[model samples]
Target: MWEALVQPFAEFGFMRRALLGCIAISVGATPVGVFLLLRRMSLTGDAMAHAILPGAAVGYLVAGLSLGAMTIGGLLAGIAVALLSGFVTRVTALREDASLAAFYLISLALGVLIVSTRGSNVDLMHVLFGTVLALNNSALILLCSIASITLLALALLFRPLVLECADPQFLRAVSRLSAVTHFTFLALVVLNLVGGFHALGTLMVVGIMIVPAAAARFWAISIGGLILAAVTIAVAASVCGLLVSYHFGLPSGPAIILAAGLAYGLSLTFGPTGSFAARVHPYRHADA
Candidate 1:
């Protein structure tokens, strides 16, 4: 059993690279996901993931399989959607969710159309599904670099961002950091998603970002605890999923997300805070 578990990673350089990339993504993106959950912006993260597709497709069209072009394209596209969604929400009667949904749907269609026009289904699958087991050194470096930048940016932005999440109006009234915090957070989301795009693909990347965060919600009470729990869950899922993919001949990306999904389901049923079992057998405080 130990050999079965340890041999693949020990023997295969690609497995090690995939593990490192998964850890990098989980460390950076999952915390951002926790914030998204706290701010009720989880769907916004999903929308932004889809929004990057067209840009990535354009990059593919121009520079076939070039990581730099795809990353740049995804970053540009995600930021554009975020800004446009914010603009529409501010300038019109439509809510942010409605605008985001509209934009992402259009973006998804455009991305698919572009890919279909110039490439085969295999190419489209590569864009949508990713190639985790085949991560080159460049992809690994990009993931690590993004992880470093994301953690640093989040550290600097932490207090203001917490303030913004807790009370937006108060944050706006008390300081000029409100819009700065908002846009900066959006940029981090885009940056992390772009990183995830290379490691996991546009479709599954948001799962890596969101699922662990969602599962951690039931386990953590404080923001710091939440971030820690989310990252831990993500790492565990990545390991399990990678092993399963190796043993069962499953797709690595979906296997990872499915592992996360399993964690989410277990959290829903058995976690400490808001889980089904918790509600059924509520913890009783001792009389003071």
Candidate 2:
């Protein structure tokens, strides 16, 4: 059993790189996902994931698989979509969600068209699905760097973010940091999504951000507990997913996400806080 688990990472450098990259993504993206869940913007993460595709595609067109180009392009595209959506919401009758949806749809179509015009089906698949097992030194560095930045940003934004989550009106009334907080958080989301796409691709990257966070909700009531639980679940899913992929010859990105999905199913069924089992069989309190 130990050999089965340990031998792959022990023998393969790419496996080790993939492991480290996925762990870093879990640590950074999961906390942001917790807040996204609290704010009821889970789908927004998916939208933003797609929003970055055009930028990354542009990068690929310009530089042909250069990590620096794709990363920058993705960041720019994500930030543009986020800011544009916010701007539309502030200035027009449409809500932020609607505006964001429109932008992402357009962005997605544009990205796919551009890539197809310039590249082959294989290149399209690489842009859409990523190649985690082929990560080099630069990709690993990018993942680790984004994770560190995300953790620091989350720490600094925690208090206001919690306030924003609990009561946006109250946060706005009490502090001038509401807009600053919201936009900065969106930027962090974009950053992490950019990092994640390098490993999981735009299609699967949102799973790492959102699924583990949704699972953590079943197990944790407090914000800190939710963040902690999410990080833990994401890391475990990454490891298990990598192992399954290595042994079974599966796609690493989907394998990791499927592991996370399994965790979500289990949490929904058996978690202590508000699971299906808990709903059916309430815990009894002793008479006072």
Candidate 3:
């Protein structure tokens, strides 16, 4: 059974591409996701995930199924949504959360309409459901390139990003780098979302981005521990999902997402981060 399941990688180019893409996305998404969870901006990442559909639709219209065109279009749309959300919060009485709600709904609706106008439901399925087995080398390279850049940027900005997230006021008072930090993270997020969306689709991208990181938080106290755990969980989810997909014919993207979801669920229920599991188990009481 194991040989039968694993045999496809030795023969199919697309399957090979899918496996590598999944690995890249898994490694890339969790670190930023953990930070987003820390900042209470999980919703922002969710918003970005939804925002991709429109970007994808526009990309399809602009250049068919080409990965580069789709990625560029998605990045532009992702940035636009982020900027608009920022603008509405600043200019109006509406709070940041409320502005995000409005933008998320608007972007999703627009994406649906654009995709509908351009192609049939089948094409929409390609954008939304995704075809991991259909991934080409071009798409795989795009995902890897985006992930590499994201990883580099995050490494360089790790200190400031964590500090700024913890206290924007202190950062603002101490360093003029605050503004650059804000948009730079968002820009990186845009790239990550675009790259990841092709694999997980909008609905499931947040899982890839956040679930592993959130899961890892349950077991670790330090940022480094958290990041390492998140990476491990992300990789595990990808490899596990790929195996499930190969053997059982599950959809690779959602299979991986569901795998991530399982990790998050387990962590949430049993993790030390005040999850339901912690409450039920009462580690302190049990130990005492």
Best-performing candidate as measured by lDDT: 2
Residues 176-242, candidate 3: write the lDDT tens digits. Answer: 9888898999888778888887777777777888889888888787888888889888888887787
**Candidate 2: residue 255 Cα off by (Å):** 0.4
What residue runs in model 1 are displaced by over 4 Å at the alpha carbon? 284-288
What local lDDT score does residue 18 receive in model 1, on the 0 to 100 scale? 95
**Each model's C-alpha lDDT?**
0.94, 0.94, 0.82
Query: Per-residue lDDT for 1-288 in model 2, tens only?
Result: 998999999999999999999999999999999999999999999999999999999999999999999999999999999999999999999999999999999999999999999999988998898898999999999999999999998899889988888898999999998998999999999999999998999999999999999999999999899999999999999999999999999999999999999999999999877899778776632222
Q: What TM-score do all the candidates reach, one by one?
A: 0.97, 0.98, 0.92
Q: Choose 1 or 3, whichever is better by lDDT.
A: 1
Clashing pairs in 1: none
Quantify how close model 2 is to the true structure by its C-alpha RMSD in Å: 1.5
In model 2, the Cα lDDT at residue 153 comes to 87
Task: RMSD for all candidates, in order, please.
Answer: 1.5, 1.5, 2.2
Residue 101 C-alpha lDDT in model 3 = 77
Expressed as tens digits, the lDDT of each residue in 155-241 for candidate 1 is 999999999999989989989999999999999999999889887888999999999999999898899999999999999999999
User: Model 2: which residue pairs collide?
Assistant: none
* Cα distance off (Å), candidate 2, residue 23: 0.3
Alpha-carbon error at 163 in model 3, in Å?
A: 0.9
**Error of model 3, residue 37, in angstroms:** 0.5
